[model samples]
Target: MVAKAVVKPAVELPVRADEDSWTEAELAEVRATLEAEMAALVAEIAHAESTIAEDGGGDGAGDDQADAGAKTYEREHEMALAHNARDLLVQCERAVRRMDAGTYGVCESCTRPIGKARLQAFPRATMCVACKQREERR
Candidate 1:
């Protein structure tokens, strides 16, 4: 009988230090990144809303159904974009709150430390890469 090789999963990197161990500089960097993102998101949402509103206004130049349909489609697309931006803004704001609470960079699911690289790429990530991947697999 041939024995099957037992494969083990690769161990994830050790949990990075918690926020408590982080220097003021580290926390400040995250705070600044989150705040900047929030500001950008808010501005984007505002601009999208304004544009959508303007597009919805009937200039009375073309009262045809085709023009109305086209305008409707455009308004819908812009609203979707604004909604996505709003969601991102909420996430950024939540990250800021977590920073203030000294819980930023900690995975919400496994409670593991989210790596600095991941954090740098996505300052509002609430889950570590491993946990996020696992969640996606489900």
Candidate 2:
């Protein structure tokens, strides 16, 4: 017996269907915001890494218990900050890729246009407000 091939529906491009979608000017603005955020995150990550490295070289040769504890705490704090910066940088990079692919300003989950106001407030968003709310609830 021959098996039937399953045909999937064609994916729709992220064309705007309503005023809620982004305008060209809005897209440009979002791009600029993402770029600025990415630059700041990169710089922050670099500084954190440098501070962590500089603090790691100490042998604690003459340090008291409190000094060692303080150094450890500071190093851990810098590491946590660097990790968060890296996460934000990755999100910014993904937003830029979506813009290039003509898929920006659309919700990833529902395939609907995200609201302009939401995008302006949070350029790293990949989903519409409703979808994001549902996700957060889950």
Best by lDDT: 2
Give TM per candidate: 0.77, 0.82
Superposition TM-score, candidate 2 onto the true structure = 0.82
Candidate 1 structure quality by residue, lDDT tens digits, 45-135: 9999999888777775856999778877888999999999999999998877666555667798998788766776788899999999999
Candidate 2, residues 28-102, lDDT tens digits: the string is 777889999999999999899999999899899999999999999999999999999999999999988777766
RMSD of each: 13.3, 7.4
Off by over 4 Å in 1: 1-21, 59-62
- Global lDDT of each model? 0.76, 0.80
Q: Any runs in candidate 2 off by more than 4 Å, and if so which? A: 1-21
Model 1's TM-score against the true structure: 0.77
